[model samples]
Target: MTTHTDFRAFRIHNDAAGYRGGIETMNTAALSAGEVLVKVAYSSVNYKDALAGTGKGKILRQYPLNGGVDASGVVVASTDPKFKEGDPVLCTGSGLSETRDGGYGEYIRLPSTWTIPLPTGLSLRESMILGTAGFTAALALLRMQDNRQTPALGPIAVTGASGGVGMLAIDIFSRAGYAVHAISGKADHFDVLRNLGAVECIDRHQLVFSGKPMDSARFGGALDNVGGAMLAGLLPLIEPYGNVAICGNAGGIAFESTVMPFIIRGASLLGIASAGTARDLRDQVWQHLASDWKPAHLDRIATREVTLEQLPEVFGRMLAGDSFGRTVVRVGKV
Candidate 1:
């Protein structure tokens, strides 16, 4: 590999008035001070990344910060005795792209605690394909399982089935022997969702309610990616003692609901915040995704690969809700 004093990155700048992000060249020394510096091979786009890249959300508190939440690559240098040069590693969440210069650049420097040895059986490219979204999905599934959710409890519902987390959740749940019901606004992608192991697909409109506080029980549990009414609608339908893993707030954050489900039915609503999870837990989830929980169709699920220069257009597509599955960003040939 060729080493250069400076490399390209997509950085976000914020001032007293505004925020903006675009491509720029940055020196390796410009990276945030950390114990390890990595030559990033691959990164993946997330909804948070799109929000940060376009200044749609206040995701980055620091100005002139490199922006990417997920990166997988080989270590180029390390002060931590546990890691050495050329070791493959991946980093996600743990305040990446928010408090530190993240993976959008060719090189990223981060504390050793933020890095995980790339799990065996997953290549750097495949690991980036799972990225933070897949990890969140896996964590959600594992949480539900720990809560005693099982395939014998009837069908499990997954909201936002067309997005990265939803798609992966569908694949994971289906493979785990549960009947999968995918909820999506994009009826056009019904076939694709089915191919990902959704036994059935429900249109988002079908879940909409007109002031009703409760609906007929339909699912044993749910993995909800879209919040708001979709989540509110889901609560009443969970079987007694069923679990709902709440992850994203893409649809909206607020929803009105009563406590009938939890109070009367004894249902559990589990919140999944992959970003701030303990490092050991994160490592365990990565191990699960690399082994027993690994999706069988990873290569088929990833929809596109683009270079760093192509990110702006991709970000625009994602913001418009026109993208699907995973979009891996190739920072350097790997």
Candidate 2:
């Protein structure tokens, strides 16, 4: 069957005219090279998507590309035998929206290496609701566990606890038997955080860190979405041999901290670069998410659902710091 057909995409472009993104008619033939062509059903917005959609951040390595990093849909056609017509699949990171056309379109061509079969427990829609945000959170937990960080060490502190990754992390970590201590500047949302399984909620604005490099151990580890001062402050409070997974740089990139946490206390700071994650590890994380690590509050975590026309408004709100939870984008009918 011929896969070439006209479809709409939230494509981004840059040239002499300057940076911009909006809905435009496109052809499946023009999509970036891949073995699997999917009729996209759902995608989700992340901080990176907002940045890429609005040109606020340099998320795209090349121009004239579709702009959603997370996508799930049914296969329309496939050159690879692993996928066939109407089989559900999903992909996150792995170069979508950066080096290639992404999920914001009604149809997307996905590399076989990155396409994942829809896990048994998740539907195509639920898979995108988790998206890249949830993937990063699960990857952090897996790495922390690999580094020998355990629940017996102490409670895990989740910074930026009101945002997508933070909220999902609370649900995932709690389901895996870790006591989650949520730290957020939005004190008004503490009760909501509790409902997502946070046992303790700390107001970050009122958090006072003694400038000292070493402090009393208050947490076994942390999954920090805010970096800069937040990362600097968290290190000193981890238990011995604890692991801190840094997934986001919402606060700032640079930070000043002493080596006491690493040298004296054996604290490990793990970097969570979800994009470009090796295929094996990516598969491992997805498997766990479909089973034991799946969040119990996925429906609640997906707080907003929008069509492609509403992406600009969603991007504005997210970049303005008004984003609460995950925003699922309904791309096209399956």
Candidate 3:
């Protein structure tokens, strides 16, 4: 094995100079401690990655770490018996770019517990395209279904419809036999959302919710990427026993609501903290993502492919709300 190969990483630092991120030469030996050392093939951009890359949000626990929350690669070395020197694997969340180095580098050392063997039915590139965004969506669905959410109730509403999670949700949920009502601020992109299997496209700007804690049910459930008022508003419109799996907060954090929906309607608000999901649940989510719950429109959803050098521009676009769908990073050979 290469003991100390020279590789490049999109490293972030915060110090006397200030918070910044850029490509830098690094060594495999210098990467954060892990049992598995992988030659990264691909990584994907999530809103969280953008936040970490630009220091726009408090994402990383420590500084001077490589920046990327999702990665797929071929293992080059491992101390763990479960992984070998030539296995394909993928990881999302589990502290990448948070307290440790992440997948923005050509190489990554992953904690064996968090690394998933590339499941049957997904290529490395496809896995990265699904990455963290699709993982969150699938996890939400799993939680929702476990709590009794079903397609028989009504259509599933996917907010932030053009974004990575939302677009994938439309595809996943619709494929799972539920009608999907997509809501997005970007009205012009409604056609694409529809093509991804959204039965109805509701413009976010035009959709209004009654302030009442309980209203006439419109959706069976929802996979909401927008929190704040969007969350508060949707609560009242959910069917009885419907689950709202919230995975993002792009629309501000705080929200005002009442217990009427919970008490009278039995509505559920499932917080999808995907970053630190447990091993068993993570395994379950990945298994589904690689099989039945996989998004059908992965190619359409992966809107851009870029190298490490182009991350800054991508981050800027994501932060400015100009980015839609997933942006895949070709870290090395795919």
Best by TM-score: 2
Local accuracy of candidate 3 as per-residue lDDT tens digits, 174-242: 878889999999999989998999989998999988788788999999998989999999999999999
**lDDT agreement with native, every candidate:** 0.88, 0.96, 0.92
Model 1: C-alpha RMSD to truth? 1.9
Better of 1 and 3 by TM-score: 3
Off by over 4 Å in 2: none
TM-score of 3: 0.98
Which residue pairs of candidate 2 clash?
Answer: none
Q: How should the candidates be ordered by lDDT, best one leading?
A: 2, 3, 1
Task: Output the better candidate (1/2) by lDDT.
Answer: 2
Model 3, residue 296: distance off in Å is 1.3
Better of 1 and 3 by lDDT: 3
Least well predicted 10-residue stretch by lDDT in candidate 3: 206-215
Tens digit of lDDT per residue, candidate 1, span 77-143? Answer: 8889999899999999988899999889989997899889999989999998899988999999888
What RMSD does model 2 have? 0.7
Q: Which stretches of candidate 1 lie over 4 Å from their true place?
A: 1-4, 16-18, 208-214
- Per-candidate TM-scores read 0.95, 0.99, 0.98
